[model samples]
Target chain A: MKNTYTDSGAKDTRSGFGAGLLELGRRNDRVVALCADLTGSLKMDGFKKAFPERFFQVGIAEANMMGIAAGLTIGGFIPFTGTFANFSTGRVYDQIRQSIAYSHKNVKICASHAGLTLGEDGATHQILEDIGLMRMLPGMVVINPCDYNQTKAATLAIAEHYGPVYLRFGRPKWPNFTPEDQTFEIGKAITLVEGKDVSIFATGHMVWMALQAQKLLADRGIEAEIINIHTIKPIDREAILNSVAKTGCAVTAEEHNRYGGLGDAVAQVILTAHPVPQEYVAVNDSFGESGKPEELLAKYGLTPENIAAAAVRVMERKKH
Target chain B: MSITKDIKELEAWLPQVRRDIVRMVHAVQSGHPGGSLGCTEFFVALFQYIMDHDPKKFTMDGRDQDIFFLSNGHITPVYYSVLARSGFFPIEELRTFRRINSRLQGHPATHEGLPGIRVATGSLGQGLSVALGAALAKKLNGDLHTVFTLQGDGELQEGQIWEAAMFAAHHKVDNILVTIDRNNRQIDGDVSDVMDLGDLKAKFEAFGWLVAECENGNNLIEIADALLLAKSLTRNEKPVVLIMHTEMGHGVDFMMGSHEWHGIAPNDEQLQRALEQNPETLGDY
Candidate 1:
């Protein structure tokens, strides 16, 4: 496997969603878009401009937007609802539960501005528990892509798959490293680096941090493996087990709470199949405050240094 | 759309539907019957007399046909009865209301693959938005069929309902009809006591809806006329709403006009008394 990745550029993941949605509008007439007064923030202006008749502007009402999306599916329309991650998941959870998930509607809940990366918006806009809330719903597909290209790929991919999905992305411009022409297979993990010391499982923006951590670990002579777990629900258990079997220990990293994000998902698989030493690099059950994205990430211990430290700690806990 | 069936033939189904509603709740010993009984005339008038739908060929998309969403899904007794009697499913399925492994869930759900339900909506204040979506879908598909939704008066207290009200008006979602079952009763007591819905028609009108009212919701003629009037009011660049004034339990004497029986099943004697009041015209399910 390739051990090194080069960043082509830096771009916000929400723009990738916009590019994908605009492309979808051109490709499929059935595809429609809805936004709860955050069309520009969610990067849905291209879609709105291209498909004026198809786009629905539900002003400031997340719950109604969710319901309308569910209803749109009944008439054979594929509705993609866009909003901030907090409003998309938490504010409209019941509407999603009964109207979309339980009803089994084919609605794509595209949530941007996830986690502390939503910079200066504070805890109110930055949602760390959205992954848990969406993944817990039966038949809900929870996806948190690592970067721009992957987010775009996942957006197009979910349009093909007929079911409810919660596609989470972020606000800040991060490294664009993933393949631009990649096919995003749901529930599949991408192994970024091959190594034997420890497995570093990461999702969303944290995957970039894990890549940096791998380079840091390499300097210390530790060959850390990095796998991008983009799809949190229907998680790729085989990839997790295979990596841990070779490495004997693991470190989970995500831009979410440690309790119910990628770490817990990885731990559940490891505990059930192969018992392994694992460390978590995530928010320690605390809400984020208004600050620069990089500052919050560093203060909350979600940087490359923190991931590298967690990898070393887990390696120490590895038996033998 | 015109009422295709004779008003007498449509009225003939009311007693049997009422019997099914009471017996279904009584048999399960759980389920909401008051609202079910209250909305019997409206359900019958829509499913049997008014809606342009084929019960034998049910599809989830509901394209090219008028679709109805029950926002106040607790009243599944009436919905199930009307659907069964309309040939959406076997009439015998009414016996399985709220029973284990039955399509007739305690609340109306599309989860069990029930024939008529397009969306699961026990959670209040969501159906109007859903109906507007379907209406929009119909517009996009060039189907031109209207979408219908029923909401409980108390359900308007949920903020989502008002949000949908504002949305429907703002978007010019004109191809849908929303009927509020103004039964004036909720779980706690009179809806006035729990939380007053002051001047509901005026509120909907202010939200840019063409509002209609049915003074006697339990009467089939009034409901049919109101539904027709509401249907006529659609496609005029404004959504239509019918404020239907109804008694909580309309058919049975003991249960009528009270919130006490909103969710409780009628006991054996009460069921016997309720059955006596509405003689089964079409055989019970």
Candidate 2:
């Protein structure tokens, strides 16, 4: 059979986010960017330089930043708030909930350095529960794109889409596996390959690992279907059920806690429709320590080998 | 009473606003009457003399005319009465206060698409930020019209107010006027006993705001003068804050002096007695 997957190279998703923001600035005058003392870290220097009048530097106050974004929406401005995942979610969750989500303000909360691979920053900086915190809010859209190209596409898409959205991406460079020219559609899962024995559902930094796991599973005579779920809230239910219906078993992989992250989100859907044997390729109940990005990924059980092993375990459980 | 208007003309409407407060509260049987009564003259002077607004064409983005936001939304009786009496809507709608499908919600909201409200602001400390944003938008659009906001003195305890205060001062947001109803009453008790806001006028001045005080917030002439001072202060220098002193339940007898009447509605007998004190001058809702 022909090789169905290809890695274009490796690139951090934050670059894609920056490029998308710059493009958005060029296209629309109503689009404004706000950052909480992380303009350089968020790769927002281009946007700031180009549209200094439209950019608002909120210093280190994430709470004030969120409220300002919500207020900016009243003037018909599409505001994108950028910060680290921890500050964006846990630190200012109430602000987002009240001012943006509950009030239904059209604000884009774009978070960088999500998950354990944020590396060297340790567990304090790495926010694994951001997706769950955002997803729980009513009328809030949660999106976690896989690679550089996908993250860029999603950033541009969310800028165009109205209402509140939480776009999450990471700091570590990953395999640029996704096609560069692909358009992003919110709440739609992309099926990368087809198989019958097991289905691999993954998101964000873990999608590339799931693809590698699919290859490993094929070598071991276990056919694994790969589904890239970029949007976690308003999740693509039809695609997940159809994949699980065909594959008979499933494994969810993500670089987050297994408690309330993508694993829990996918597991809820599976149990509701087409209940089957499944395995979660995610971090257990343990905080991460300071390490290199690659070391952290392996230490947290978010590697391709871990996914492949979970696939084998799930496939064996499918027999019962 | 200090206004230049003929006494006959002014006296005819003052009691009507007070009556509207009592009737609107009695109709819902559960709306705030104290602050509404306290803020009556300010709203009366605003809708009556100051703002060149048309009730018939209440636009959300009132480009040509000025805009007003009530941060202390529990005083909806006065606001609703002023809007209705000003011709924003029919006077009959006042009877539907807090009822199912009523435009007048317990807290003011933009979700109902009310013509007068620009944004929902029942949750305290958000209106100043929003008003500042509106002021900023007006500046960006090159519109010279200003934004006005009224927040409760007790509402100052919220942290978001300080955030907005700092932001407005830092940005030199001068096209907005924020007033605090310094009635010294809150849900718990007197503001001083509950949480002393030590020298609020000095505090705003220290925060780089042009501070103005109204000795009688219930007097139309004093309010108009305070508003003029606010206008003269509005340049590119700083924002203006009016520390308004008024009785919690200014016109009503039983509701005054104590914080117990801050948010409660009076019974039929109490309403009758209150209406007798301030006789229906224009007409009751």
The model with the greatest lDDT is: 1
Per-residue lDDT for A199-286 in model 1, tens only? Answer: 9999999999999999999999999999999999999999999999999999999999888888999999999999999999999999
Give the RMSD in angstroms, all C-alphas superposed, for model 2: 2.8
> Which candidate should be chosen as best, given DockQ against the real structure?
1
In angstroms, give how far residue B166 of model 1 lies from its true place: 0.8
Candidate 1 lDDT over B1-285, as tens digits, reads 445457667888889999999999999899999999999999999987779999998999998788999999899999999999999999998988898999999998989999999999888888988988888899899998889899999999999999999999998999999999999999999999999999898899899999999999999988998899889899999999999999988989989867999999999999999999999898987
lDDT score for residue B63 of model 1:
81
The weakest ten consecutive residues by lDDT in model 1 chain B span B1-10
List lDDT for all candidates, in order: 0.93, 0.85
Per-residue CA lDDT of candidate 2, range B1-285, in tens? 344664235546778888988988887789899999999888877777666667788876577678888888789989988888888888889898889998888888766677787766677777777677667767766778778889999999988788788878887888888888999999999999999999898888888888989998887777777767766678756998989999999888888889988888899999999899888767776
- The TM-score values for the models, in the order shown, are 0.99, 0.92
Tell me the TM-score of chain B in each candidate.
0.98, 0.96
